[model samples]
Target: MEDENNLAVLICGAGAAGLTLAIDLARRGVPFRLIEKMDSPFPGSRGKGMQPRTQEVFEDLGIIDRVVAAGGTYPRMREYQSDGTHTEKDIAERDDPTPAEPYHIALMIPQFLTEELMRERLAELGHRVEFGYELVGFEQDEQSVTSRLIGPAGEEFVQSRYLIGADGGRSFVRGALGVNFPGKTLGVRAMVADAALTGLDREVWHQFNNGNMERMLSICPLAGTDLFQIQAVIPLEGEVDLSDEGIMGMIRERCARHDVKVQSVTWASAYSMNARLADRYRIGRVLLVGDAAHIHPPTGGQGLNTSVQDAYNLGWKLAAVLGGAPDHLLDSYESERRPVAEAMLGLAAGLLDAAKRGEMRRGRELRQLDIGYTESPLTLNRPGRWGPLLAGDRAPDAPLRGAAGSFRRLFDLFTGSHWTLVGFEAERNITSGRKGLHIHRVGPGCELQDMAGHFRNAYGLTPGEWVLVRPDGYVAAMVTPDETSILQMFFSEVGLTDADGLRH
Candidate 1:
């Protein structure tokens, strides 16, 4: 009951997480097929918040404008304390004077809108979502993976060198691989609803009313319609069931005191959050992403943001490896992202447990905390201040100008091929030697003013800050304006060659 075809990658699921990975890889010309079990995308504004970091990633994918058109900006946050109202610190605005990477505030976009934009963009690259195709079974060998999918078209078997399971929390891929998603599913329950109401200041979040626990409410504004991500604790005594009337009664009572009424309700769900991370990202030829890799409480508002970042980190690595980089390059995906996931999971647990114990104020301590890892193997040469960059770690963004064109970032143009080299030295300073590296000159096609402006104003590129950007956009290595260390980095990571092989 199945047809078969050999594809490069057969990605499972088509939600925001799945679609994001697919679009990034497809754009790089890596052949892949996306499979979804549902007849269509999951309904409801399920996760209705986008952190600023995600807004930047959305920009890289070329869909931030559409996401903006679909959702409004984040409403002002109101922080509270027992003594009095405390002024919330502006964490979004990083005071550091860096011209590159401009997004400092989170964008509020609906989950469905995010997925649709990514899907449409992927279509622009000529890949369509394979809807209703569910993965019923899969088998992997030393060379490849074979998956069985069932849908409206019946059964089809897919063959590929690698597989990704972007399927959600109850992921079939995780189950199939026998990987342990070990962690704690705590007994903290809350009710979230999407509904229409009036008389409430819909834009700003309202927290702690008249010193009553039952009166607490959190409301988020979405873009396209009169939709809000409304949340309140479940009020029933003795191990509560998050039933409809129980949830609605809590909402009605909180709103009633304020003279606000919910005239219509769209959707509601109740679940106690679980904090967990997978023991591994790759089980031979299959890898896990998003909720499939890790799950956490929604306290920090990091769930969607972390998953999308995971896909971005993995997408380019997969493209480069499939395009013929060493398989060891793929190993760094788990090494880089897993620790970040581990950090987030621990952070989520801390915030969630702190809230339940009613030690409410300490939850904000994360903003002022100076976190570092003397222990993370992925940490680069400068470990304390540069936890985000390590061996095989993602390079921070910088504005690169060249004859090829003026780009808002170094990551933008490098998305096309394996490696991008930016240097302040003349073309004569560039070199091709024994190891194997690709070098493109930075002059001729583009203007010097625009290029110089991007470097001086956008990135703090001194004569010595000549940066070496990898194919995947991580800073391979940094040195003073010496062509020796810079070109050596390219040769060590990428080969110095054309189609004819290694250049002299």
Candidate 2:
């Protein structure tokens, strides 16, 4: 007999994607169960780079302080050539933080540390990941999904309104759905590990290559830790010895440096590069996120960041749908994120090829700040509205001065699970009470003043214009004072009524 337990959402896998969705739903008071097959948290330094856009997501999730505190900036690269000459240079171009974009550079934090930080935040929100619980099988109907999960206790059946597959690249959820994951293997293989080593400066990423990219070995110091991540290319056909002693021998043989010695390895794994994307993101009431939906090469450091953002985008829609919004809201998840995954797959593959040719240079594209959903179905654009930032672009942060002389940021106003409306020189009548919406007015005689012109400079708002930001920090719509009816219709379509805010 199947034990009956019903939930709003059943999240499979406890990695970045799963934890992110869990945290989001927990904060929204949406009932969810996050389950993972592993008995403990991940302990590897893979996916160590956090992009700037992901930092913005973390800020809104209220964990940016902890994430920033636990991470450090990327270090310069020191390349040793075959002629015994070495040179040091930056791995990527660094940018100065501005009022609109505070996190202008990628942060260096191990994937394990990032997951631990998010798990802590999730616990504080009164929820915890159910470890050792594996999703064995599942079936979906029009109303709900019945999932068979096996834990330490035994098998139990769970009924949930929806099921999300945030499992890794080889996701069982995706496999059960039989969704076509189509892509080619890039024929690149390497051994990656975290080890304590001496005779290396932690200030730079050490690369020892004898004028051959295929024979290169890199030892990068993991930020905020005493360990170094060692990566060495291995033959594609041969079996790699993943033991600590073997990894140490490989490093020693490749570098040929008598001074450097590996003390011990905390974790080690063999990695093969592949660029694949799921043919479909959703099948009925079940959906996929992160590596389950798309897998990328580690060249560009986009996988984890993209995965986290996938959960960020899907969380609000799931909450809204469960709260009585149109079920079609769920469809927007695939439409918005799949194309991004496709693009990122291409980018990562290109970077991998560039690295093979010894021509790789991390740039702004890897920072992921330019990602947006301007072409998404949910984005509303007024024909004559003119600005660099449009509907579906990320809402920029700016300094604000309150009427009582208190300083704040636009992000501060957008810190919760509610839509935000920023009206510039807009009529006061439009700012009237709206359910699940926060209104802020700027311009003459308004409560908040853009003292430094940061808001105006970032948004380029004309007088009497307004920007409606979605729960995920993207602009849902941009309108003029004359387009009030359009705004009302949008709210109505999104299940927000004048009488009931979000209909919870």
Candidate 3:
């Protein structure tokens, strides 16, 4: 039996990335303690855009409804011109939801609200974020990670099977681990603050730019709240004053809108452009994630989104390995996510450069819908596949009919923390025997009927073809019924025996 005091995983930092991983692990019944160096939850809207991919992740985590209810869409941009006239433009082209991609547009919610929803969901799963616990130091061996933590009470030593540094860019754990964060600073400094203001239309994102691009200021209303987030570029050698008066004065000077009063400032910080990636994500039993692993410009709103994706990708692998899956299964986290981060870093840096030159544009690339892991070692694909969807592609959503005329969706079936086996025309007797597996058959008079044939076309599946959807919603293996051994081989390679199943 495992000791209750010794957690399976100890997560540092209770931000979006840390909370997400905690929620996923809790749902899987994995023992973990999520800690934050701060005494209370962050109370600002630092990273406010939730991409389509992240919405799907939230759906699987069972917090989609709460997120939708709490967040709103990105508002139109109203640029304040030099002639005292405003020009309105859409932030991005709006795309309606389709059968394949249910969430076609991004959602805008304050980062604090997003974390609150996740924390609520985590509490429902019987876990709480331990506040005021700071990880001062740690040492890890082949078997476990012993962490030195300082808290309100005092310094205490704790042990865990694994340690993850989800702390922000100034990660003590990452620094202690000696991982090299290699990248250059773009030398652009900016000041951001969340404040309650007046004399601005809350329906649009108000932008004020000086002539010849000498200065720029944007006051974006935080969705579903009475506050606005102030963002503006400062001089490379400019002084930064993070006090409330300083923030208000800076806004007044930059926007030149004396009518727009900064009534109150809640949170303020100065940040410089630093596009960097840790040379390695993992060193022995300690791992780095979120800002600790990668940091880039927030131009494309990819920093938080990418960080959340990292947690989503790593959560299941951690659960699997703790449950007895092969140790190498954990290695795929770095192999798959590093490339995505690398791409995002370049994309964000380029977008930042473009914005500086007044050539910024929003497109499908920022949505992150097309990111995949087709090149990962765990992805099994056949040559000459007859479909656009492949082994490593994201499993799309489709409508389905359950028994007794019950209606459901493909994402509803993939909502839990378990590997799902979906068969088109295969026998259930062969696929349903596995423990902790949810098997669904899609055919006439079957457990699940493709109500509109969306699944068939979306997956490009023949009658006898089936696919293995990993717990994280990636296609692990796709094969015909005659090649069912491929599933067994893949599972065996990952050591997915009874020992590797979920604890509960």
Candidate 4:
């Protein structure tokens, strides 16, 4: 028998993906244990670019203020020539914020600091990561999973209703489950380290590349910190060193400037370019996420962002299912996230190839704003006509005037861990009618008023049109208000019931 308030989920890794999932679960009152094999948090600057979509997610997680305070926009790249001259160019075109797209640019925050903020939020929700604890083994039946964990205490056992593996590319959980991770190694190896440097401008990302593209090195200044992240390509066949001398040696050999010196190395690692996708995201009561489910090159900065998204997509589904939703709801996790991983892998690979050819150009392609679930089984589009945004697309944010003469944004309504229903030009009582649904009727006397027509232009909705935004911010169903039964059917299909405990 399942206890009413005991641990229900076991997360195998305590990285960004695992931490994001844990925070969401904590907000939903889902009991879970987050375990990390490492003795402490990751202390590197890997995956430093927080894309716009991920920033939006950070906002919903209530860490936006901290993130924005701890990060800064990407700096311009200054390329050094073989003749000791340098040419400066913007890394990417800058975009001003719009009413619909609030986070218009990528923010640079070190991966470790990002994880720190997330852990802080999780702690406020009354849980902490069990560091130095390793998942030694686990087994599952139809009901629960029995896991063996080893730490300073020697051995401990836990029984959870589900097991999630977010344990990087070489996941022990995936290996034990015998899931096939299929892909090719790009035969390119790279080394990265965080260190303090001298004779380098902190205002720009410094790079050096030969005409033949045989070598490339970049030292980018990390935001909200004094350390710079050093990155360089290495021979695929040789054993590359990760010491301070090795990194400084590469910089001296590749760069035309001889005055630059590495003062100290904080953390370092050498990684080969391997692109792989798991054959399945789910098997029995076990599931995969983050680098465990898919691993790829970090050229596009999609790896970490995609991992956090996987957690976001899974968190609410897990909560709903545990709260009495259907088992099929859990299936949607794989259906929605696996394809996203596949696509992201391909995109990252393409970007890696471009960087290899010395043709890397940063643009909106890596932003991930266009990622959607148009093909998801959980999506329902029953409108007689389409709109600027589709049913499966991300719901855009727009400013609104509240009935109490106050102002708010659509994202303000979407800031919590709950599903939201928006009725355009509908009755005022529609917002107050639902309890858990968190309905917002956008019209006169309602909380959301489109005074500037921003919402109208963004959603392309007519009067009485209804849109059901999922807890994860994807549009689930869209239909006319009169077609309430269709909306009811869509909810039932997606394993959600109305506030009255009825379909409609």
lDDT of 1 by residue, 1-504 (tens): 112354778889887778888888777777788888888876567666676557656767778888888877655555445464634433233333244545544566777777887888988978889888889999999878988888786886789888999998889999999889999976666667777766566646555442333455666555677866677665444554335455456655655444555666677777777888999999888999998999988776667777887887788778756755567766777887788778888887887776665444323223212222223332224333332333343444556564545455555545443555555443443444332234433334423323545444433344433445554445564334444654454453333454555333
lDDT of 1: 0.64
Q: Candidates' TM-scores?
A: 0.81, 0.97, 0.96, 0.96
Query: Which residue pairs show collisions in model 3?
Result: none
Error of 3 at 287 (Å): 1.0
Which candidate's TM-score is highest? 2
Q: Which portions of model 1 miss their true places by more than 4 Å?
A: 1-4, 78-98, 209-215, 235-247, 357-418, 425-429, 432-465, 479-504
Root mean square deviation (Cα) for candidate 1: 5.1
User: Could you tally the backbone clashes for each prediction?
Assistant: 10, 1, 0, 0
**Which parts of model 3 have CA positions greater than 4 angstroms off?**
1-5, 210-213, 427-429, 498-504
- Using TM-score as the yardstick, the better of models 2 and 3 is 2
RMSD of each: 5.1, 2.0, 2.3, 2.1
State the lDDT of candidate 2 residue by residue for 353-458, as single tens digits.
8888777888988877888899898888977677779898889999999989999999999999999999987667474577678888987799899897999889
